[model samples]
Target: MARGKEQPARRGGGGRAIGRVIPWAVIGLWVAAVAVLAPFAAGLDKVKSDKVVDYLPSGAESTTVAALEEKLPGGGVNDFVVVYYRAAGITADDRTTAERHLAVLDRKYPGPPTDSAPPSIPAGENGPHTVGADGDKTTGSSSRVQDSRDGKALLFAHSVGTASGEPSAYLPALRKLLEDRPAGLEAKVTGPGAIEGDIDAVFDGIDAKLMITTVIVVTVLLILIYRSPVLWLLPLLAVGCAALISMAAVHLLAKNFGVVVNEQSAAVLVILVFGVGTDYALLIVARYREVLQTEADTNRAMSVALRSAGPAIIASAGTVAAGLLCLLAADLNSTSGLGPVGAVGVACALIAMLTLFPALLLVLGRWVFWPKVPKVLPAGVTGAVAGQARWDRLGAWIDRRKGLAAFGSVVFLGAVALGLLGGPGSLRSQDQFVKTPESVSGFTLVTRHFPHIGGQPITVIAPTAKKDAVLEAAEAVKGVSQVVPGRSGAEYAEITVFPKDAPDSPAERRTLKALRAAVDKVEPAAAVGGPSAQNLDTATTSARDEKIVIPLVLVVITLILGALLRAVAAPVVLILTVVVSFAAAIGASTLVFEHIFGFKGIDPGLPLLGFLFLVALGVDYNIFLMHRAREESLLHGTRRGILGSLSATGGVITSAGVVLAATFAVLATLPLVPMAELGFLVAFGVLLDTLLVRSILVPAVGLRLGSRLWWPSALGRHTDPEDADGQASVPIGRERALRN
Candidate 1:
């Protein structure tokens, strides 16, 4: 009999050994994969394309111009302005030094070397231009050095050959050459080329900075939530692995599938991985801790925990992935590319948290909780018996005043949402940066000195046969200051039109519109493009994308929620609550932006990106609560189940919310206006959803509706005896009682 018993015990031990081996094997494989792909992942930034045209809508006028311009004589032209200023009035010496510097630039960085003979010039017109040492003559289309009306400043236009295909590559050397100045004269390079360099410089080192800040923020929050020196490291380590995997995957996708990754998308990807990964880890860990209070065996506890929390985690990830994927429908290439990049990050985080996180916890066992170690309960004791009486009382209070709580919550959110009406208008390119760069300062100096000249001229392309007609119409437009004819290709000619207003001013936008209308009437095939035109087109496209994409995102998320909840009423209510939460957050942010922070105006893409993140991510907390409540309702009935789920999930979900909010808040520390605005809106929105919407409004509504909250689901039809009696269906003191 002893031999027989030992044989059975040995067989059982072998079975358990296999279970232990599987998790380690999975972890080891992931580690090896990460090591193999780490190099490629590190090179992702090397492959990113930040071309201006890359971000615009494919069919936009600006995009068409960019493509056509590349096919011109020297491939294209990189145009910039060198402004020389003196508060005492520009002196002769200033002009001499500026001319000498221009000559040096011409010799060193000659424009496209002409292959064909100079075109014959018409009589009385500027004679056929001679190729200067700069490679192209300063033609009628080029603005040569001219004194400002005030005599305080002089501006000269410089063009370089774009045949090399990297206009920005020449900026650093040009900026350096211009840095040596003559006394009493200040020279600054401003225009598209210089501005592009400044923007690229801002994005430089952004990836490393973003990673450090996000990691620090997440680490701090995890320490606070876990309160365990050791426990926090587990999720942090898991999330870090997820980030690495995500980067590698994104790199591969971009390299193989031509996915676009810019500074914005890359930064957002890191935050998503850490934020969403930590959230999934929290849910799993919380459930595991609860299970540990009953099932002393660590493996058994995790098994039960995963089974309980897996559906919510999986469903939440699915919803986020689906919502982000909807961005593919966006007309803006940058916005569309963000969809896949962000979705990949979220998917990686989910896989790591569900697999690596659980495996690590099992391997480390209950001791990982350290000083706050959970203990197996005594026979009659329960999981919630230790210190949750506050949550119980809070639940009871809300249950009693359901109507008051619901009404009060709605009123508060609605009032905050009214601030949307006072928000400033669309943001312009000049206002895109949080802090002024050298190029912007230079542009401002030009505006002060040359009050009549636009910062960047509007470029128009018309049929070569109608060149004179196009120029005449452009010059006759209301706001036009001058029109200069440029190079002519096979069938088209380029004209540079200077407007009276500043490049990004409201007056300038109107001028561009008027110019377009006038030019189109004279030359039907003409196209208008330039820095200002690009900005206008971007804003217009963003607005159109908002109208189309917002409704689609809503439909997608609603269908997802409906499937996950298995109840039409519950999904509708959740969607409405999240939408209200989003509106309230945007409204509150608009006030902060306009009055407190003094932002110029909102980015045109703000509403769409804000809605995409707020609604999809906002509903995550609701999903956690409702999924748990639905499970409880099967056992305890709807009202009791709602209270029980809130009590059980309240702390963990709040912790998750804080983690996510803090992660996004990292973007506020960046120097870009759009990123900062997006950060604040999403962060504040999440907090509102977590603390007020999920905790107060959602619970109150669930209590008020009772079983009807679940409409058509089996839980809606099932009612416990205690629910009918208007008593607590299950005692709230302990997890066992709450579940019972």
Candidate 2:
């Protein structure tokens, strides 16, 4: 009989163990495959090599004068103009140097205007058009400050790219090109691009800051968790490898698949690795310890823990991955890129925790609890705090009175939530990037010197082939104090008008409505497309998504919680808790925006962003609690189960929260408005989830519902252990509880 049982047990152990680890592999492989495509990682390390070299004004002046009339676009339509004013005359040498620098940069630029206009006389609408400032003070020249008295000054500026791309990367090269000039000349490339370029410069310091913080925080947490430098070794190794490979994959994918990582996504990746990876390892290790107390044999305990805890971890990872995927609905490309990349990181965390972690456990399990001698303790206390009498006493004290634990969670979350009143807005604008020095300088320079440079002039285009109705459509608008019959070409007609600003300001909205109404009357293939048109498109896009994404993510998150818990009520309660927390997070972020940022309205996109992050991370702790509660309840009973689960995983969750919170908090240091808001919002949300939702609401809900919480009809039901479905099928605390 013994031989027969032993043979079957060995076969079952080998087969079942392999089966249990499938979710880990599947989740891991799927993500790794998607992330390996970044092409822009390093640029041969030369910060200022081969930038723009020359930009010269040709004196073929009168010869090309007709070309200028053909494309006589106003100041706003003109690209950037660089101003290099000297105290003396600008000779061929000065012109030669500035022109060469500008030319080098100009060569790399994808030529102005994405449309098909022949590259004729690149100066027509696109080139080194020179102009004097409003006045040359000494000469009292009417053409202004752009020109120096002795002609020693040179001004250089051009539209780098649609005024859409950030300038930091390009600005440095421009600055260096000027700095490397044959001396005595000052060149400042003041444009939207230049300003953005400077802000990007500040970001260079971030990678170093993140590296130090990760090392310190991880080292400290490891020391506290394992108490043995030896045991902390494997988990640290796992996180490092996972983070490195995950990042490499994101960059690689970005390089190849066209998914570019913005500053926000790049910053979030480090924190994601530490927090998510650490959470997975902690769950597996805690379960492994529980298995040890009863199994005695280390191998059996290791196999046993993997078979049980691995699925929960994988399911937790799925929720995170799915939450990130919802970003595809966002209008911003920066946010859209985050959706898939964050999922990839979660996948990496799952893999490292499941495979490499198990192998490490096999080698290091014996020595993991060293110095303290591996003595078994009652259920729920990790060896990390095993020897501390005061902690044990406190743990016991909490076990004795659970009500206080419940109340404290309510008080803390409710208070932090009070800030919710400040959140506002419906759209985050590109203008937010203007808060930087480069942007401010560019804005001031343009506003002061180029009065006609504020807006993208509205252009109505109809085929050169259509004249009657098209021209009629153009003539029907009410705001047109004047309409110039059509200028640019047979193919393009330019209508100049002084229409009121509608949709943005109330009075303007009225003017726009009338203009739109008149346009409708003419109905000439008319679809709006300039700055106002883009805003209308953006508002439409945001409104449509608002009606959709959040509710959908919430539903998906709820179903995920239910399925992960394997209980009907548990998922429902967890969903509700997460929803309430999400509301509070949004409300709090709103308050931060209104009172602190002093912005008018919330960015239309901020709500979805806050909602998704809160739901995802908040539910992460929920998974920890439910899995812990079920394990502890089966081993002990309902009341003790809640206490035991809290004690075992609570500390780790809180530590993960601290690291995540701190990393996101770093975003506030950026020069851009959106980044500052995003940083604080995400950091504060994580803190609320870690401190309140996981530790308090979950335990309190568990306690309040008691056995009823796991109903419909049974969940991890512990009793006679002979049944195939019995919860205590292999519980360590079962024998002791039976004896008691």
RMSD for each model, in Å, please? 5.5, 10.2
- State the lDDT at 124 in candidate 1: 18
Q: Which regions in candidate 1 have their CA more than 4 angstroms from the true location?
A: 1-11, 112-143, 163-168, 385-387, 522-524, 718-740
Model 1: lDDT of residue 659: 95
Estimated TM-score for each candidate? 0.91, 0.68
lDDT of 1 by residue, 4-53 (tens): 22222223687778778877987897789889988978988877888778
> Which 10-residue window in model 1 sums to the lowest lDDT?
116-125
Taking the tens digit of each residue's C-alpha lDDT, what string does model 2 give over 1-740?
01122222444676657645554564455346434422222321112111110000111111122123234232113234466644555666777776677676566543344332211101112223442231112122222123332355544444444333435545556566567675666566654345435545656666557656766767777778677757777777777667766776676676567665655576667667767787777777767765666455566667777777776788788888898887776654445667877888888888878876776666555667676435555544445534335434544555444467656766665776776644454433334552535444444443343332333223344334543454565456654322223334444443333332322444443444565555546644432333333344445555566567777777788788777666788888887787777767766777767777765555555566667777787788778767777766665655566666677667666766776666566666665666667767878888877777776677766765665566553443443243222344435445344323
lDDT of 1: 0.81
Best by lDDT: 1
Residue 41 of model 2 has an lDDT of 28
Backbone clashes for every candidate come to 0, 69
User: CA lDDT of each candidate?
Assistant: 0.81, 0.57
